[model samples]
Target: DSLVKQIDAEIEKYFSGENPYRFTQESRELYKSIGGTPFLDGDYTVFGEVVEGLDVLDRIAGLPTDSHDRPMQNVVILSTKLKRK
Candidate 1:
């Protein structure tokens, strides 16, 4: 989809040094240490964030994570659906 392509393009820009927020060595190392895998595995997509559940998202993001940035407990999405705007 177009959205997915856009996300991939943005990621490529950051990784290829075309974006101002390019990944740094320290960041990469930290990510690896925290067990954060590269975003290539499709765990996330362009249209994944939920506007109404942002508080929950913030809490999850704040959780204690391992060296690879994976949280100690698994956070699963039970389901997702779009609401009429």
Candidate 2:
């Protein structure tokens, strides 16, 4: 199935100096302050980071959701791309 084919197991790092891309000190500190799960460092996969539009993310995350956590309103993916140096 195409959906099954799209599934992949890839490791992603959430900390600086570990992944191909680095998160800012501010972000790292924010993660710590927010009590992010650093304990699951190597367990699951992260895949990518959001370099911008975090404000939008916060707004969406703050929206009321159902028991399953799906937003009551629709959210759409407009575009996405990997960062390149």
TM-score of 2: 0.44
**Residue-level lDDT tens digits of model 1 in 1-85:** 9999999988788678563535789987887787654654346545444678788889999999997679999999898878766
Candidate 2: give the clashing pairs.
none
Question: Relative to the unseen true structure, what is the C-alpha lDDT of residue 55 in candidate 2, on a scale of 0 to 100?
Answer: 94
Cα miss at 78, model 2 (Å)?
1.2
Question: Largest TM-score belongs to which candidate?
Answer: 2
Each candidate structure's TM-score, on Cα atoms with residue i matched to residue i, is 0.43, 0.44
Off-target runs (Cα >4 Å) in candidate 1 are: 1-45
Tens digits of per-residue lDDT, candidate 2, 1-85, equal: 6665444322323222355435699968988797565546557787777899899899999999997678999999898778975
Off by over 4 Å in 2: 1-44
**In terms of TM-score, how similar is model 1 to the real structure?**
0.43
